[model samples]
Target: MTAPFDDLRDESQQLDSLVAALTPEQWAAPTPAPRWTVAHQIAHLAWTDRAALLAMGDPEAFAAEVAKALAAPESFVDDGADEGAAQEPAALLARWRDGREELQEALRAAAASKAKFPWYGPPMSAASMATGRLMETWAHGEDVAEALGVERPPTGRLRHVARIGVRARDFAFAAHGLPAPDAEFRVELVGPGGELWAYGSEGAGQRVTGPALDFCLLVTQRAHRDDLAVRADGPDADRWLDIAQAFAGPPGRGRPPKGPRPGPAA
Candidate 1:
């Protein structure tokens, strides 16, 4: 648990370092996400951190305030409803950095030993939030990389991504209004650490396996499943792949990568 938060702090710092290295032109580069520049991705991550901070401090109030703000008709015009709508890029970056630091401070100050917050689905403990933060940082980091056409160095935080992939397996299946397969799937990551992860079993459900980084990328929709070495076993594996969702929201069909390809195995 401590490792998850520590990893979150580390990832945030890394993201800052990565952003700082970008030239002005690079900052404005277009990403795979239509209408979003690299700066926009960073701003979004900052915004999400702010949301997580509010949720940690006061879940009920946070939910209420967010609902009130987003309920406005004019909210959509803010371009993804960015809180720092009128700010310059530098100002937005500063706000994002400051907000991330504030979130870290708040997370540290709270009683980490016994705290749980309502997430999009599960009641996430402090540890889960830390892992969630890691997942987000890495995912958004990918957005920056895709924009710049540079590869990022995958690290231990990938385990967080892998964990999210497992959790999203059920969501992936249910996205199409289909019953999730009732079986257990053993997932193995052929990493330097030889990581062993699993979800439902073969008789219980489908199994997903491959390099940890690919698993994360597949679930995040950052990389097409076919481009990666991920392997799914069991009868239902292929079915699960079509609808996996990592982010919280109503079931969404992410745009296929630039071309047609096979999705995760059911």
Candidate 2:
């Protein structure tokens, strides 16, 4: 398997390729994310990569930025995206490409040193950071793809996203002001190649089962849980499906179901 940093680079490159040929008009096209354009999506990625770089290379500066974010928690992310989106498309694209490349190099070095960096939550080693970056890249790329009317086939990299989602089970509950469940829940997902990726003990009574794509989309808040094929076995597991989120923040206003709820897999 490729290193996590390599995987992150590949994910960023994939997103870069998607936008490399887009016209300025296409860059301006609005996405499913309320009021955000395709350019805003890429800009957000660039801003985050730079923020990660700051956290790694200069903690003091990163701390100051964190304070700013905390001061305006609701608008910080959008404010950063808006600032970058105001740039010309070509300039914004160049900025994103350069920033991601720099961050990828930093990640490789940190991985070798076994260094940990600050995050919104706990500190993260390079591998964990890379996995997180990969998740956000794929999630935001989905918005850009939707805006452009493009289809992105699932890849093995989604396993990283899935693992994060599965691991974040407790965090998801906490984010929604619910107590974390005590019993371990088994999660089994069908990967893109039809392989079963299972987590937790098979003996566990509570379980979540479905296509990996749906699970990943659910955890990322890119798709509503009701619209997905993912299902939960026990009441706790079912409640979990209602508010799973891979990313950190106050609960998001998630996208509505695609149509009438297909309901969970049974």
Candidate 3:
């Protein structure tokens, strides 16, 4: 099995390569994320990377920081982004690159399986933190890619994302103050390389099936569930599709369908 830390590094490098080629005007272009430009997306990632490093290195300080953010929930994330986005494009890029390196080193220095790291949502194991970072990188990369009108090719790394999406089914429901469904659903995805990845029992009454890319897109709120070729069987499975979120946070309002639902991107 691939380590989440390795996947996190790969995802970051992919996004970094994309951003490295962007012009100043392109860096300032708006993304699908509300009121956030390409610079804002990278800035947010950089900020989170710094916070993750703090959580790994100083639990008390990280806890205090989380408390401060939670106290002003509505503006905490936005305020951080706004502040970071004010930097010049060169500064923003260098900050992100440095933060990414620092975070990877911190995660590697610890015993990933046993060490717990503080986060905005809850304490997480190093492995989970790495996975969450990978998810965030990919999701934000989508925003950056869209802003540049460039379509990124799907990769097997999405399996990490899909696994998180499946695992977060209950969290998704609970985050919205809804009771988690009692049923266990089977998830089967066709990977970018045409390999099959299955989670849960095949005979499970509830099932979600689709291209892995689309599933990741839906879970990350990068694309509306309706826009993907994903299908859910059973009421609980269907509801999971409506609220699936891979990244930690409040329940996200996913994209609305644009015209008739389109097929999954190649």
Candidate 4:
């Protein structure tokens, strides 16, 4: 299996390619994410990359950063993006690039360690952190691509995102202040390569089934569940689709259905 660190590097580079050639005006163009422009998307990713670095390399500093976030849960993320977005486009891009590289190295160096690191939620290993980073890059890159009126075809890396989404069923419920269903829910996703990726037991009573891309999009909150092909067989399963979120943090204010508008190109 390819390392999650490698997958993260590939995903980050893909997002970087989309922005590397963008003009300053293009960088300032608004994305599908409300009040956040293309620059803001990239800046947010860059800021997060830096945070991940701190979490892995300097636990004390990361805890201080966490305190800041707790003090301003609603605005802290926006504040980071806004601060980074204030920089010149070139400089912001450089910071993102450098930050991701540093994070990549941190993950790589700790790949053999079983130690868990602090995070907004529970602690995670190096590989889990890398997977989370990949998911974030892909989700934010979706925003940047839509802003540029371009499409990024789903890649095999989406498997990583799908896996996280499937595993986050409980987190989804908890994020909404609801308890998770006691019974496991079966998830069967059709990957970009047309292979089946299954989670939970085959005999599970509740189930979610769909194209992997749509599932990832729905889980990431990049697309509304109503707009996706995902299906749920039970009441709890149906609710999971509504509340699914792959990334950690507070419950997201998910995107509404695009209502008659064409989505990103194929």
lDDT of 3 at 234: 93
Query: How high is the CA lDDT of each candidate model?
Result: 0.72, 0.91, 0.88, 0.92
Residue pairs in candidate 4 whose N, alpha carbon or C atoms collide under 3 angstroms: none
**Per-residue lDDT for 21 in model 4?**
92
Q: lDDT tens string, model 1, 102-198?
A: 8777766664467788655566777777788788888888888777777777887787787787777777676567878666567767553665555
Candidate scoring better on lDDT of 3 and 4: 4
Q: Which regions of candidate 1 are displaced past 4 Å? A: 65-86, 192-205, 253-255, 258-266
Q: Write the per-residue lDDT of candidate 3 for residues 1-266, one digit (tens) a residue.
A: 24788889999999999999788899889999889999999999999999999998888999898888869877888888998899999999999999999888878777435778778776888778888899999999999999998889998888889998999889899888899988789999999999999999888999999999999999999888778999999998898888888877777667777768468999
Error of 2 at 14 (Å): 1.3
Candidate 4 yields a Cα-based lDDT of 0.92
Q: Looking at candidate 1, what is the lDDT of residue 243? A: 61
Instruction: Supply every candidate's count of residue pairs whose N, Cα or C atoms clash at under 3 angstroms.
Output: 19, 0, 0, 0
Better of 2 and 3 by lDDT: 2
- C-alpha TM-score for every candidate: 0.84, 0.95, 0.94, 0.96
Candidates ranked by lDDT, best first?
Answer: 4, 2, 3, 1
The best-first sequence of candidates by TM-score reads 4, 2, 3, 1
For model 4, what is the error of residue 250's alpha carbon versus the real structure, in angstroms, after optimal superposition? 0.9
Q: Residue by residue across 1-266, what tens digits does model 4's lDDT show?
A: 24798899999999889999999999999998889999999999999989988888899999999999989989999999999999999999999999999888888888888989999887999999999989999999999999999988999999889999988889989989999999998899999999998999999998999999999999999998878899999999998888889888899999998777677999
